[model samples]
Target: MAITDKFSSKQIFKFLPIVAIIIAGINAYYTVNEGHVGVIKRFGEAKDQQPPGLHFKIPFIETVEMIEVRTRKNAEKMASSTKEQMPVTIEVSVNWTVEKEAALDLFKRYGGLSQFEQRILDPRFRSATKDTIPQFEAEQLIQDRASAIQGIERRLTEEMAGFPVIVDNIQIENIILPAKYISSIEIKQTEKNLAAAEEHKLERQRFKAMQAVNTADAEAQSILKVAEADAQAILLKGRAEAQAIEAKAKALKNNPLIVKLTEAQAWDGKLPATMLGSGTMPIMDLRNSQEKGN
Candidate 1:
């Protein structure tokens, strides 16, 4: 019996190291997935970092905590007041990630990701939104929505510098204003449209009036031109008639025989009705008159 006991003890001692090694291997190694990093802690203090994939650590004394380095999103809805002192609701989303270099510092300070978001990120986001939204009027906020969103994002990013996380992006998902303001805006728009329509109508009427005036002016100009031509024609005709009459008078003065010729041409074949005296008549030749006298 003693001999059998001695052999069994020797065999157990030989396998003890292998069992211990197996246990240590199981506890010493860990895996980190893509987009994740591990923080190794020694004696409850953050010592170093491990990148993605398999990593090893001391079995009992060291511990590893995985942190997501990939981008993450958080959405928050907040009530705020605009520059007009109007009440509004804003829904915003923030995309962020753990800064890899700051991972150990973050873990040491906040203990975990959830605690960090709740204690630091959330408050800062709320404060930034509240501070920025009041700078703009409600109408401006709605009209310049994209600019407002960018402003908020910039403010939030600036405020987040105190934290260990890097802000990747931010967005304003929605903005809700009071009902009365919307109704007032609609009324103003309708009035503006009506005014514009009235102006257009007035402009069209003015254009038509101008067209009528231009047409009248053109017609008056044409009538004046025609009247001038007619007057010129009448003057020319009168001058021509007067010239012909003057020419005939001058020709008659130049030759007295022309008058006798004209009278002979005008006379018909007729004798005188009476003779006042027996002297030579005006129609007798001078030679006959001289013989009679002798």
Candidate 2:
């Protein structure tokens, strides 16, 4: 008489495999990576978030979704124009991340993060860039590049205020302008440069002319001073000689013999053949005396 067992040893061995499979399925777990967050859900709906390592959820009924929590790059293109129907092209990029406290909420509301590009990023960024870029001109975009990027950042921040994302910053990489307008501007710049060169040359010429005039004036003044000095010396000498002659004449007024001797001594015996306005008449005594001295 033997007792019947509920399971045979073979059946238990098969059950052993089932039990191992169940255990293995239950043991399926993951670690949330360093810069990532996990969204845990029940029946494909987000329930909670786990951060940075070792997480477990009900194996069959619960689901976990991993999302990158680090900052992400969204490189984009934008354009604007000067109201004059001018077309422009610009390259833009943004650094962004999910708001930490809102990660779980975002996953829950936005259908588990599959629609980030569509629901959150694309629309919001497009709205921000379009709204802000159209306000600037082509030249303004080139010159105020930093300000343009800042505008995009500010607008994106404002647009995403109700969302669970943060715009770390915006970068405007480059701007392209129309070829015709740029060429015209370059030509105008060349003309401006030529005008500046002409102006500089004229200024130099004017400076040189002024220097020449100043030098000529200085020389003329110096010559006037020298001529005045020479004339003054000649006048002084003439006055001294005239005074000496007058004194001698007064002294000779009392003595006639001394006058004759003075006249003889004054003669160099080179007398003129004719006197002032003389009619070739006899000036015999004066001629005879000068010839005797010679």
- The lDDT leader among the candidates is 1
Model 2 weakest lDDT span, ten residues long: 1-10
Q: The CA-based lDDT of model 1 is what?
A: 0.88
For residues 258-290, write the lDDT of model 2, one tens digit per residue.
Answer: 978978999999866646555656554476778
Candidate 1 deviant stretches above 4 angstroms: 1-20, 208-294
Cα-lDDT of candidate 2: 0.79
Estimated TM-score for each candidate = 0.64, 0.63
Best by TM-score: 1
Error of 2 at 66 (Å): 1.2
After superposition, the stretches of candidate 2 with alpha carbons farther than 4 Å from their true spots are 1-26, 78-80, 112-114, 203-294
lDDT of 1 by residue, 24-65 (tens): 989988998889889999988988888898888999889888
TM-score of 2: 0.63
What lDDT does the true structure give each of the candidates? 0.88, 0.79
**How close to the true structure is residue 259 of candidate 1, measured as C-alpha lDDT?**
92
